[model samples]
Target: MRHRFGRRVCITVISVGALLSSPAVPAVAEGAVPASAANGSGPGYSDDATLRGKIISRLQHMTVQEKVGQLFVVEVYGQDASTVSPTMAARNRALYGVDTPAQVIDKYKPGGVIYFDSRRGPDNVQDPRQIATLSNGLQTAALSQRQPIPLLISTDQEGGAVVFRLVAPATAMPGNMALGAGRSVTDAHRSAEVIGTELAAVGINQNYAPVADVNVNPANPVIGVRSVGEDPELVSNMVAAQVNGYHDGGVATVAKHFPGHGDTATDSHFGLPEVTHTREQLEAIDLPPFRAAIAQGVDTIMTAHVVLRSVDPSGAPATMSQPILTGLLREEMGYDGLIVTDALDMQGATSTYPPNVAPVEAFKAGADQLVLAPQMDVAYTAVLDAVGSGEISMRRLDESVYRILRLKMTRGLFKDPFVNVELAAKVVGASDHLRDEQLITDHTTTLVKNDSDVLPLTRDPQRVLVTGWGVTTTTTLGNAIGRRGQTVTVLETGTTPSQTRINQVVADAAHSDLVVVSTMNAASVNPITGLPTASAAAQQALVKALLATGKPVVVSGMRNPYDISYFTEAPTYLATYGYTAASMESLTRVLFGEVNPVGKLPVTIPHANGSGALYPFGHGLRYDG
Candidate 1:
């Protein structure tokens, strides 16, 4: 039946006991999903208690295997239900005993699927219509099941350094650190809304974003540009704003890598890391943003794989620690929301517990959703066995299943699991979103050092050279500068530029009136030595050579502001924090004095010796003042 949007239709609830004893029944018959799900105007969906009863009724009727399946969100290999290529077909057949996404969904009946733009595998994203069509196809496969439940489609759409899987034609904002640099709560909310809106338009209902980890450690390899800032209070405010923003944009928000993935040198994707901070230190440094997130009623909080030595002396990562997940996050913090593990596929998760064992451990430790299960066959079976063996109590399983159902209901996934494939293109990457993104990016172009007023290039330099580590990044910046009627030359040197490339840039700089050198983590430290790497040495050589040209030089740190300390001899420095096309364009405008740069340092720029701050946090020079 076609339910009109906003109509107050009361859904009658059946007896829970009867539902438990009876054979499972589908929530909605095939080809009969209501329009409320797609339109976000479901009747009585806003009434939490009413939705709770409906979810409980559906939960009681689910089979044991279905309940277990509800806990997993697997990574499928194609943009659509059919396998895209022979390689993907073989991989899917081997992994799930099926060569197509539809067949895999039919067999495993997983609760959700995650999309990724990866180098090693087929990308699950193409354009907006294709993604929306894929989502609809998956939902159609899901609804065809005997006991249907919609999938919670998720992706890491965290704007900055980590590109959202949705790709271009989707609005790409200036990441979390850029928001931190802007230091405006409104900008944070707006940027998140833009991201969430674009994601939702493409039928992705959940985002693993608003990285709540307070990046106190400058040496942090992964979370540096992804995190908002170093201060807990600032991060907290930003996190809360994003939670509200994502909701406003019609997608569930996830505050990730709890209790904190910050303050560590290790990247969880590669190796296991430990946070040895005491309980006092953790509460003061690593947890305020999470607390703020919980307060904002975030839909899910993703567990980190790192061990908190102070909280759980057993040395278990947060994903497998009952003391940390249940005692700390659930009981002490009073957060009753869903706890999801951060990709069981990561080495940090699998290092201690194998792929088959990690999901069971994570569930036992109180995670509701087990994400990115690499070994789906083994992981799914292990969880099922754990439930059947009574090692995982039925009540415990039901608790997680209930949260998963409740999320679907709250998000109106139950009423309408599909998106309008036609409207997706119109909503995603719209003109307004791009404009707002540019405005926010403009606010994030931080002018850190403008010694002797080398900036606001009052005299229009006839010739300009823009050389950077990223090829597209340099091209984008050169294009932007070229639009301003300057003769621009663009050169891209991969992170470690050779001596020949360095000499080429210096020679080119001699011909140009002004040289712009962009560095990508050129000053990143070696984890053990807490000093720069050999790769940093190569990029530094290029920068030092450009500075020696006797011509005016502008060094732009495109990833992190810390690279400025490596080339202090340059007359001027700017921190874009990220190299989104919007960032490059906005940066070009700031260079020509078309817009005044107001972005500040979210994280302090430390001395080359790593002793103290070279430029303290909140330090940004302005063209006007």
Candidate 2:
């Protein structure tokens, strides 16, 4: 069960460095003390002032090598004595005696930590409260040695498939595409508040979210379900709502993939992508959401690994292009927030330049934070050298540090680095969590097609056969059926389909009174093109199989709603913008007369082969009373 905001809030740091024997540390203003000491003077510290002072104090006390350490954000997970001990051992041996959480915190402190599921342990999952307690304990341990400076506890909580579930009391909200369906800024605001409140309860101060990429291209491999909508204005409004939601709840929000990744057909996580739109087209469509987010006082912006040839003719991706990051984002957009680089270890970044060199170039290009490095020492050293050689200005470093510290201050990190674990346990997963989960589930399930009144499935349909490559026992859809009926049967089709196998699955469905077909475009890897077109084989076989079922066939989209055209013959169709357990339950309720389908298409579903662009952006069927 999910926790309420107040309950979750009850639950839920680092380091120093080498000094002396380095070339000229930047001179600090005389009598300037650490921000903690300067508190209670004047208007108190705004996020900017507090952050500036902290960065300056660190710069004054840090050696060149230590300064480099501050630039590399390495990946670390888990607290199993055996696993962490060995990982720390390797860091100590390779990165100059830095080992243990204490040493990592005290010596080579990185700007932030990137968390994933593999890092969590079984003990942390006993209950919502226990999860909160364990998470708080883990964070507390990470920063035990340092004074309260805002340490960014970050995660990719974009809803749907990208949620981190191990932590206590943190409930996953609906994906952006679902929010976009309602086209209601109110829904967006509510979502942000819910997500932000849960994050605050668990001690997470930063969320890498509100994916600003416009989903203009239906075939976009990576951003289909993640984006809010294709229309720039709609995306902008929704982004602002999400940012405000996080801020109101006391967690910083990051607007991502600047300059847009909406029209591209490839996934940046696997390889480099190029967007060939002219500057005007990009400014008109791709940049509005970012601008809106900035206006709403978003704390951070994450750069995409997309290469926009028209925007930056320098032949470098936006993550490493000064013309895009410095000139366009900073100067033109008037954004003063911390600019973070997307994971540098991803092929999009690593494929272009050596890992060590990329961090320095990214900094030079005006990135405030370098995320996900393969070798922390190498990347850190490269940045330090670049700064020392005067290739990157100290002022630029100060600018980045100022924004980061400001965010920390705004989050009240300096005042209270730890939450009362026992209290957090009491409130972390309560009624509010469940309520928000239901709201998102209700608001995101869309009714794309309902012919012959097949929906609100008659009580106890004689035989129900669920056939799709995407449906499985673990999915919420499967769970919903498993709880009430024994007659339902589920079929799993891997990533792609086999004509022979699909035939057998469909043949079984023909005997059933109701047949539901599902498909998903989970991950695509085309470096040269960013499109995520449906597989021809899968599309053909699924459509053929569903048509052959003869029963009332309901084609359900468990991913983005775009691929529904593949099963054109189905009399009834529905789109659950995401595949979360809650969404699946909500979808089943609509199908089985449990709840009304209130969701509308947030984005257009283009025809196969890009023929007919049916249901253009913001098209959804409203069920009138």
Candidate 3:
């Protein structure tokens, strides 16, 4: 295994222009020959030669079209093929020859592929083993067509509400906020190792995680619970530890939403968000974690579509800004690993730049990969034209390609690109999964308030009313409560519930002895501003109703702890750190007095009037009585 600093030096020297401008390609002296003459036996073509050589030689032979295709990452929801329209399929086939996994692999040959939770097996049969089998099968089919360069398989397994390991046998880890509560870098490292080990078992080499953004803005819509915490230095340490953990487990990590999305009030998924901060301020607060990750040799950095006017005065977002990507991240911060643009389909990038031009601009701006292009042909062609026309040098393309190949080589992708289905099945659902889940559950339960000795809900409560938005029949919290109490009523609210639902919740609270209200913000935000709009005034309204009942209202925040201000009057409040099943289960255990809440609040919760009276970064109330 490569030491973190050693890997960083190797990637940086070769990737950051020192070797790009060298008179001779590094492999030429090592006996690299043309592909046709060598019969794949050239110095650069053999497996004996560092895997990097084979990748470089293959890339050297690739036409502009093929090279551009290498930079494009297509989004395939699942093996079903129905999620993508036939028309779109036909278009992909026509443009990049994307049809069967082999055709797509042999034709467009993307550097990576990203999967969502929807790609897992069918509803009833979904399990980590099933996911591993399906993923390995798909990857194998792609490799069988042509000489395979290891395809980077990635997923958003950030744990908590954003878990893909939903089925039985696969364990869920707590979110970053929960890890933050432990206030131990070792805890963060353990969490990363657990997630990395599971993902690696299933052939997922890349995890889009260790959200580097500092959760400074209380109202940040999407990044609340996902962030590690508000302090830049602490987040930096945690991010570094997480990266080290992943690397230790042979899983690549991508520190995301770069240039800092923490202080912004809007979410970038919907539109572009403007970060109104001086360059110095951003450097001090927002960019510290990312800088730390880069310093720790993180494998990749994903750009955010956030506009930082101070950094790039042209109003260009970081995803499309040369100043931010090439100048700041690469030149200033010394990050030479793969630079990936966030999904092109996102409104933040798509709305600003023309569809065909965005990918090209992204490459020119220093991104090595373009994710989820709407039209591969137009995007690929634009990049090819840029390279051929010298708008972006072939050296630049080579630089990016080399770094990507190095990563593949590091992963031993060239030696064995295929996965053993049976072995994967056994490892995917191994005992380690369950153990890690339990550890995270135990670590995330935070006891915010236990005033008046109203905990452990004595034996069984006669009437328990639980109400919250984002809760449903399948919700783990509700199920846990149902198991413990005889009469448990759960009220579900929509994203933004109507007044009628609020009134109904108020009426339901009247007869309940113990009322638990949960609030969640999906963290989806306005793409341009990065601020979140609280959906459903229900949290604010439910507090008033629960206060009227004169009973202990236990308020739990499923998302970010910032929402606690809406229910400050509640005698007992807890922050589960996230909404994952593990979190919910742990929270239930705490509520019923089955477990003590040892975790502290990672982020502060302000007063309802936004007076900044929120619980400070490391505040947790423990019951001594």
Candidate 4:
């Protein structure tokens, strides 16, 4: 769901902070799946007379305005242990409502609300007590409404890079691509269950996760590492396992960027990206994983902002395209679950429709929720106006609300909407959960290329110079090297280093016994390679100069694995795939010969051009080999 382009779009890495520790699921038995798993006419729920009766009854008492309100799942700020703080007051007003969060909750009566990690810091419970209180307060306000309904609290707790939303000491599970490298469906299942369980504990029930996008295009700026892998079948199988894990663990799972966001050069956040795939192409490449997610009984399918040229000829992004969201997804695919649009604040959506009209357009196009409608008041008013004018029929408005209510009901929100603060504090970042996450890290770190067998360092070289051009925090990677008792000089060649910095690194390496270059492009987009600028020069120069030292350098692409082709001169190359502490732990263990590297590349590391990958999807090298 992240589209910030160059900004580090990940909330992974770091530690448990001042929190306790904790805590994935089992398999699918035929009718054993939850009856409320799918909203409408889903497998075992069709004959649930009580569920149907409740929905019909609720519809009769609801007003058009109330029904319209249910279609929105807006974003709100501030965490409340008991009362809102003075410091949070300013942001609360700017983001949530005219006054307090409760006022916004009572006025909008949005069916759900999502929380994102503050652009502020690490993903930890700024205060677990505060969030638990906030959840209870929001639910309290929902019940206070005339037409009372429980709020479906949601967030992007998708693990890996996007773990930003949950600030509790929750375990940062490896991203989807990392789990894919583990090459086990069980790992995928466990990862999701762990994530879902923790999210549920925090009172955020719906996870906008298990990205179903197929990373077919190597140059794809957005979906590259977020997706499971480039191959459709592997991505489908792995994601489907994760879906079951989420459901079994008690949180609703969302299969995102529906119809797929892969294969595009432009990021939808910056501008709309067009998917020129014909029906056959889409069905074969981009659509299968979503097809798998639907079959797996996911609670919601989030629409992509990208336009499917073959499906919607109007060039409208799929979030507002009836042809894609309604026609292709609902009618053709036979998916009865809810459809939620990606955040409307992104330019992909803003570029196509007026801010106030996007929700109405998406609703008419058949989306159940208008996610992160930043102009919440405008979006809400427009939808309400459309309903009154019959531009959006009462029947349509009722359908979405019915689905939203059904979702709340299915999740048992009506019965117990509030979360226990004490339980959440312990459950959010419980120690055992962190261990399981470490187990996942055990299997997901891949070594893409270890040329001339320079890995597994065999010899404990005394002096090691570890540096890289794009490194962010060198402490973890540096500390790992230092743990070997080697005097490690960690040189961070920030974003793009200067020639002087590279020369200094080389100068330092001359007297060193070994040179271990740690690269960190671990974020979403590599501004240097992702953009054409002077920075690219610094990046290339740094690596070239290091190689000129004629030292046996171990180049680890701490972020993008493709740094291999760029640093082909190095005798050894590895793809940590992330710069998180867990990733660094995996890399360090392999370097010190503690743990054998066994991860496979989840996505193909393509060459400079978008033609082919330097390392194919399944490529990897193990230390044991």
Question: Against the true structure, whose TM-score is highest?
Answer: 1
**Tens digit of per-residue lDDT, candidate 2, span 452-514:** 678767566356776675544224465576565637777776557777778777778767777
- Residue 66's lDDT in candidate 3: 43
Error of 2 at 570 (Å): 1.7
Best by lDDT: 1
Worst 10 residues of 4 by lDDT: 18-27
Candidate 1 regions off by >4 Å? 1-48, 118-120, 459-461
Any idea what lDDT model 2 has?
Answer: 0.67
lDDT of 4 by residue, 210-250 (tens): 89998876557777668887889999999899999999778
Across residues 274-367, which tens digit of lDDT does each residue of candidate 1 receive? Answer: 9978999899989899999987878899999998989999999999999999999888887767789998888998878987789999999989
Worst 10 residues of 1 by lDDT: 3-12
Give per-residue CA lDDT, model 3, range 1-625, as digits (tens). 1221122233322321222122322222222222212342321124424455566676665444444556877655334322344644564455455544344555466777776644342221256665566566656655653345668878777766654434445556777878888677887887788778777877778888879989887767668778888888879998999998887766899998889888776668887888898988987898889878977878789999999999899999899999999899878876667788988878888897887799988888989999887666567656755654556666677667766776677677767765565676676546876776776677667777766567767765578877776755226677888888547788886557667887887788787777777866533333455444456354566566667778777777776776656556667777776776677778878877777777877677666565675677678765443
Per the 3 Å backbone cut-off, how many clashing residue pairs does candidate 2 have?
A: 21
* TM-score of each model, in listed order: 0.92, 0.85, 0.84, 0.89
Q: What C-alpha lDDT values do all the predictions have?
A: 0.83, 0.67, 0.69, 0.73
| After superposition, candidate 4 runs with Cα above 4 Å error | 1-40, 43-48, 81-87, 95-97, 120-125, 459-461, 469-472, 521-536, 609-611
How do all the candidates rank in terms of lDDT, highest first?
1, 4, 3, 2
